[model samples]
Target: MKPERARSLQWLLVRRLILLQAGMLLFFIVLLIVVLSVVKPRLMIDNEAAVTAVTGAVDRDKDGKLIVHDTDELTQFRAEHPKVWYIIHDTTGQTARVGMAPPDYDRDLGSLLSSVDHASIGFAGKRDGKEMRPEAFVQKVDTKAGPVQVVTSTFHSRSDSEGFDISITAIVDMARKPDGTADWPRVLPGLLASLGIVLLPIILAMGVTTLVTTPAVVRRSLTGLIGTANQAAHIDFDTRAMQLPVKNVPQEVVPLVNAFNQALSRLAQGIDSHNRFLTDAAHELRTPIAILRTRAELLTDEPETLRLRQDIERLSHLAQQLLDHQSLDRPNEHRRVVDLAEFAGRVAADLAPLAIEAGYDFAFEPPDGKVEVEVNALQIEQLLANIVRNAIEHGGGKGTITVLVDRAGGLEVHDEGPGIPVEEHKNVFEPFYRVHPHSHGAGLGLNLARQIAQLHGGSIAILNGPWQGARVRVHLPLHRQTA
Candidate 1:
């Protein structure tokens, strides 16, 4: 069984699913930003500003050829964009010059410029079927400064001499920021604004829908099984008529439930057969036992005939005890307010003659007023009679046997013979457990009495008596009337 504080499976699954979906969405959002920044470096690069800065720093040489001279303006421009690198090639003079560039940038820029020149298109029309306009685009590339955005604008400058043209190309470098952390405040609002109006509501709706319906769905799925178990709990096996409903029950549980019903059916059949056998056997033997007793009475009034009569009576009493034990197994037929003190006096009166004939003294001490209790009268009578009989038999048939009813609705039968041995106190209440094997009485009397006491929601206990005797106490509840 799970602990009380543990979460159920349905909620655990729903929480995990929602988190997984949200994580995937956030992952893709970061991935898309990285991809866009790399493909179009201008998204993070300010190319127009760098180009104007570079052109303003350019000057004319002695031959009137455009030359990029070292100036404070170029130094300040380099200070502002520390990662920017650039190169300008003069095809007319067959001269090349580098601008405010890193040492690693100077080495790799030549090959890069060569590639840019071949692919670059000038302002002039097609030459050898190739467009001559300058190649102007933005891209991200790896350099000594790490992955930086590069915006290159390539174009031809108009010259005074024919065929003497200068090619100007400017390169600016801006390092790419780490994913998810770069300009997040600015990017997040735009990104969320595009999706927030719709996507957030969609996700929330899905999560709320799952949370609201998950418990109900789980309860609905188990409803049939729960109903079947409750019905089984209240079923009385004696009726043996009810079966668990298979319809609407989960298929996986159907086989086990049906098997349980079948077991109960088999049990009911067995109990019915056993009871029928006990009833038939008791009926068959009762007539012969009565006939024997009558025949013994008809014989001459001698010791042998009297002994025979006593034996028949013992046998008859044993049969009755057996039947009484059997009745305790069935549900009681009626319930009423029984005056326990009056009831104990009546049972003691009926058994007093037997005690006297067996050389024992029998007495009853009932309370002055009625001590009423709600119980089945027949079962209560049987309980009292068995306790009295046990006292008479165990008292060696020569000592005082007393039945007392307390105002608390407790009935106690005690004997002034050899009290039951302390070791045998618990065992003596078990069926067929005799403290003395030679005793003529069947050992089922105490067990039957205990069962009857329990049926009425009471208890019976064997305790040491007040004065050198064993005491059997039956404690039951009393019924009271309100004014």
Candidate 2:
């Protein structure tokens, strides 16, 4: 697979995985909140009933009077502990006695009274009060005298009646404790119990769902990965990307996978075409090299043989350049960090004598400091040689070829040549594309350089240079040193 396409696929997969994890987490949290919210009221009602049952049993005796066997004893007990209040009502639901003024009943006495019934022993009711709503409950009793009801009120130690309300209605009214005063610590245990009850089913459902859906999810993921691999395996080099059918994929990843496959298909075709072109070009160059070698061997010791030798040498050089270019085109070549300034200096130095022989000046101006990048050193050398040679050959031979390296890991080669036409700028980087028909070298120079730059996560571009010269700039990322 092409590196760019592979990277894109990996990125898409990572993004999709993140979104999936987030969605699952959010779904679980919302579900947990909903379960807790729904179960809270029922738990509160159950706890209220339990509290009423326990308190009612303590307030009454077998005879069922507010003062059972010992009235005076009970009163003395009540005086000592005035927080306890009780009332007994008839079966007709009238207030026979008052406990602690039913906390708040002046505004909605009708609603509070209407709710009382034989089955209302543990029912909660609310009444309007001056400051806040007061809540209450009713408890039933069966005494030898008759059926009765008991009510209680919460004591406020900070109020005027020693923080108590001593009215008869207050004495027999149902109690509503102040905020944060009720047995909230008890509610924690209840909440834990409720959570246990609630989570038991959720856990079971999660397990069951995992058991049931996990295989399907895995199957689907495997199917998609397998299908993608299969499609990539069968991809044809000559064709554009085949649009893979992507129906029924997990909604999160469908678009990304589809785009990845499309990109891969395009990349595969590009690399395939490049390989084929390299092969065909190599085959075509072999015949000329062979003929030149044969002709050079035949004219040995003759005066014209020297010229033939030179021609053969030039042909050999071109062939070697072609082979080098082909090798650089392959994507699987190993890469390592190279100092661009140093590499360019060496290349320019090596070619300086050749440039002088050809009546062209060559200069190398490396950056003051080292500029390191990741690339295949030989390929980068070949790239520099091609561009510099092209500059010498086409930039009106006598002009200076200037090689400059910058601290940003950019390399620029400039020469006093007629700038490339804007229209042919893109075409110049295509293999075997040349601007001038009378150009000396083969047209693979820029193409090979661009390929090398791309392999190193860099790029090369041609633009107008200062003083009407052609400038070729190559930019590469800086390399990091590990400790």
Candidate 3:
């Protein structure tokens, strides 16, 4: 539940989400590319065929005149159109062929007789005459212009046939019309099929991945929430607030959890203060109540009854002191700026008579003019009274009690008594902690003084003085400088 640990978990969750998204994007991109590449070529081929069919008539008209030229010219034109071929034969030696020659004809025009008795025409060669010798041949038709023959030759070319003399064949006749048109309906079906082959699996995978990761993420979130709750559960009322992880948590939950933690902290502080107050209050009242009870019990005897009444009166005064000590623990809102020097002078004058009775010297040395501090006047008076009383009672009844006030708004009460040991310095501020067990007064005096100092945003420290005595330093901020 620590803030740092929560932040780390949140970072991890973010990374996982990023990785999942990236993986999905990468998978889809690859699938799209593959589907498009496969389907694109077939689409291109179909488009090319459709364009060729649409422009076929235009091509035939543009090149029709070249086919009607002289036999030689027609033969030359046919040679240019190597994809088409025609054969012609004549009774005479000369024969004209149109288009490219067949695959097996010789380069030389030998055995010129085309058709003496019979002739054979093939992609490889043309043969004529009684011996059927190879010769330049052409396809002849009996037209209005008499028997016209277009002459052309054939040549050998490399073929897949191994070691055989293979020749090029002009099998496709460009003069012939194409048989069919392109099927446009195939476009949509083909596209859909390609998409299905490629995109469908990818989409399914993404869905599955999302489903799987959802539960994992939810579980992780729940686990983190539970962990935080468990840690909050273990928080001790008197201890400091627990640190909780804040990262990776849902935005909806953070504020509520944080508010709960803050409330718990405040509650713990209130409870600790209450418990300490109760314990100190009880301890402070015990001695006075015991004295009152003992004095009341002594009333059964006649001679000791009057002396016991005096003791009861003194017990009543001590009980009132205990009540005042309890009230000091509860702060009052009334505050004002008062000069420390004047304050110290008044407290010394009031306590001087008591010091004289106890055979102790009391002196008050205030700063020149005024050293103002923001404080509750009554509380400061009570604080000074407690310090003066403790010094007189514990100073061996003869040493001087020096009250020094400074312009810095600091006050020091120095008593010429054996200084407190350094080890007990911190403990002396604790409520009901007494340095001398056999001392007359309850041990709430110094602790109450410290509580008042703290309420005014000040502090008190016990240190060894230049002489063989204990010096109590009270440091309070000036009136204008509130902490």
Candidate 4:
């Protein structure tokens, strides 16, 4: 399957991280709004308290009415809280007195103050087990002096059976212009500035955190995936006990890993069954063929008896090739370093007499130095025997068969016979595949040789030789150090 690079596991992790940061940013915005809402009420309470403290500090008579005296404390209080104006009024709606008012303080402040209702401003009750309290009456009024914003509150002190009112006027210029127009210009920029100052840092901090952690977290999560890939790459069909590890693997890929292991198990079982069938069948056929060969030899040295003996021997060789092919499938338990040049020379010497009897010349060319390789010695011997035997049986003429070895553990068999066609070269290594239908040999020889070569981490290829012959070259890894 082609990988979607943009949608990899790390991409998904980074996307999720960004989404989480976005959610946090949204939460921060909500919290900021909540804080601003909560703080608004506290600011109103502070305004009310400042007004009340200044209003209550005025000199008072025994009857709790204002004594109409201005002290240094009152002047300082008025200077510190410029937004407040004081008013003394009788409950009977008479003209009121003002002290420390702004020059543009509306002359109509008295009429606007008299219109206030104390009972309407005292909003308090218990409803549904919840208490509600109202702080102050804050309002804007157009006065003859100009326009003014006022927070009207009454401060009352108690005497026996009598009450007096000091109707205080706390102007709220922070909410308006001198014309009492709504002062959104002053408030909106400050509100937005505060929100930006709070939100930008939070966003930058979260983005950096996501960038730093997403790759590490994604890599940590894929550790099991990398391990599973390595296991699949190195799986050997000869062994059935190996399996991918489940511990510490991610839950998302657990099922895939389990499925791969199950597939490996099934494949190993099938190969085992095939190898067993071949070995058993070859063992079963060998005895009958051996008896036939013995019976033909016992008959006379006539041409008919000699031909029959050769046929039986060919059958015996085919049976042995089947056994050799089956042996290649078994896991190699003993692989030791052996001299490749000497091994090839010995096998070639053993097969040279057979080639001589077949009206051919067989030669062994050994390398000057030892060519050592790590392999199962029995399988390597079988591989050399099969290649030499193929050349002797099907060279198409009484030509020379030469076995050459090199220092790199490479072996080459060159025969002065018609080379294989290029189209059939690859197919020649398949079991039971033959180039010539009338050839007096089963085609398992080359196939068995190929299997053994592969088992030893080597490869074999058939090509046209330098002479008018076919060359089978086997390239095996050389063992630099003896084991």
Winner on TM-score between 2 and 3 is 3
* Model 4: residue 219 alpha-carbon error in angstroms: 2.3
Candidate models: Cα lDDT each: 0.70, 0.64, 0.62, 0.70
Pitting candidate 2 against candidate 4, the one with the higher TM-score is: 4
388-464: candidate 4 lDDT, tens digit per residue: 88888778657899999987778999888777888999999998889998888799888888888887788999865
lDDT (Cα, tens digit) per residue for candidate 2, span 190-279: 656765786567655665555566556666666765676677567553234466556645567777877877797768778768777876
Model 2 vs. true fold: TM: 0.43
| Candidate 1: Cα lDDT at 382 | 88
Question: How many clashing pairs does model 3 include?
Answer: 28
Error of 2 at 477 (Å): 1.0
What is the Cα-based lDDT of residue 322 in candidate 2?
74
RMSD of 4: 12.7
**Winner of 1 and 2 under lDDT:** 1
lDDT of 4 at 406: 82
For 422-463, candidate 1 gives per-residue lDDT tens digits of: 789889889999988988888989999988888888999988
lDDT of 1 at 264: 83
Model 2: lDDT of residue 282: 70
Using lDDT as the yardstick, the better of models 2 and 4 is: 4
Ranking the candidates on lDDT from highest down gives: 4, 1, 2, 3
Query: What TM-score does each of the candidates earn?
Result: 0.55, 0.43, 0.49, 0.63
